[model samples]
Target chain A: MKSFGVNLLIAVIWLLLSAEPSVIAFAMGFLLGFVLLAVFQRVLGSRDYMRRVFALGRFLLVFAWEFLAANANVVWVVLFRSKESLHPNFITYDVTGLKPFEVLLLSYCISLTPGSTTVQVTDDFRTLVLHTLDADNPSAVRARLDRVLKRSILSFTR
Target chain B: MTMTEMLTGMLVLSGSLLILASAIGVLRLPDVLCRSHAVAKALTLGIFLMLLGLWVYQGEKQTALKILLAIFFQVVTIPVGSHLIGLLALQKDIPRWRHRPIDDYREPGNRS
Candidate 1:
């Protein structure tokens, strides 16, 4: 019963996020999605469902902070620096998280920042090749990213 | 021309210029991933500029709100698009240029 309720909420969230549905479409789509969810629910089981949502919430909070900082730094660099000050380089940094989804999210967080972009993510998912406008402070930057990722991962998974 | 019309024309011109610059950068960049970055970042800015220009040109609250929505959508979409394309390239085994020894995402057996 608890599993079904969560499944129903997930389906409804999916529907709301995806499209604007007419009353008929909404009811039909929710019914179809709910039925499919029930099958997957039995197969997958409700292992760490709450953990996933909590992890996402943590990621969002940390991401917001990083985003604000990156944007401000970018604007400052653009406004003050001449073309000569720019040093565009691609740097790969080690990411500590284990899960595929977690690694992917970290890569994304790095890429979404203004100065840094993820050019590649390795298959083993341990490393991330990031392009940065200024690669001068690579160590500091990598350490900073490592700390933030650790906080987000630990905050929810623990 | 009225001041409003002149302002509108300038905004449109600037936004169009940004869009053209991004398009050219995407085509001219040496690598696929780099080109994606150029397109993702510049095109987003271009769209924002154009939408804001349109908002200013219309000088209506509703159009301005719509323009804000457009910008919001672009902001959310561009990074996701870039990540998807990058992941796809990795899946396809695209070679990345390494200018120096750095380890953002590089490890033995983890090369994508």
Candidate 2:
């Protein structure tokens, strides 16, 4: 978080220095700041910053893919699939050791993805109740959620 | 007339179509949870795509930045909104569809 603040500060400084004051200028500044931080990692204690940034980028790409796939799946179910075949169900997800913010992100990802909407989190924050629009196989759905959303979230956060 | 204009038009059209699909899902789906799925995912993505089309059409850095910001907020907030709504419905004990829904949250004996 400190490194992120420093990076943003550098970007803003660069924006002020540049005459155009455009988004591209700010982005270029950010990129330059990233490189500088990387080069002087020992001084800045930003050893994790570079890896976190890469993980964040990968997570974003995975999220984009999930978002598109979700849209496509919903479109197919809505437009083409018959109503009788639909099987909506609630499934409990174990979130034993995840932090609150991580749980929040995971819930948001699950809610935004195909076939699932997170309905509630238990008081202990160890379990999440998800309402899946179609759960032909409950275990399969759970496994997929763990494999796709949970894994990406852990990679970025931890 | 121009290629950019055509691309923008196509993107906007598809985005609207996806939104339309979401509307259909809300009407055709069996229950509130399913409807929320349509609204949260499809509607959100549709709006994002539409904003993207606008950004592409405008082709201005400032406009693009603003649109990106708008997309960020939309993406972050929409799911939360839907989650709250779903949570409310669950708390209220809203009736679900007739389909067999496996609720693992409930005790094995309590499931209906």
Interface RMSD of each: 4.9, 2.1
Tens-place lDDT digits, model 2, residues B1-112: 9988998998899999999999999998888888899999999999988988998998975567788899889878988899999999888878988646464567423433
> Model 1, residue B105: displacement in angstroms?
8.4
Please give, for residues A53-149, the per-residue lDDT of candidate 2 as tens digits.
8888989899889989999999998988777888787888888899999998899889878889899987767788998876667888889989988
- lDDT, candidate 1, A1-158, per-residue tens: 46547667766766677566444445665666555654575565644554555576878887777765654554454345554556556677876456877676677667755567787777667777777767887887778777876568656655
- All candidates: CA RMSD (Å): 9.4, 2.9
What is model 2's DockQ versus the real complex? 0.67
Please give, for residues B1-112, the per-residue lDDT of candidate 1 as tens digits. 9987788788778767656765765555545565566555656556766777787777755456677788789876887787778667656756644445544544458345
Relative to the unseen true structure, what is the C-alpha lDDT of residue B4 in candidate 2, on a scale of 0 to 100?
A: 88
True contacts kept of each: 0.28, 0.88
Winning model by TM-score: 2
Deviation (Å) of A150 in candidate 1: 4.0
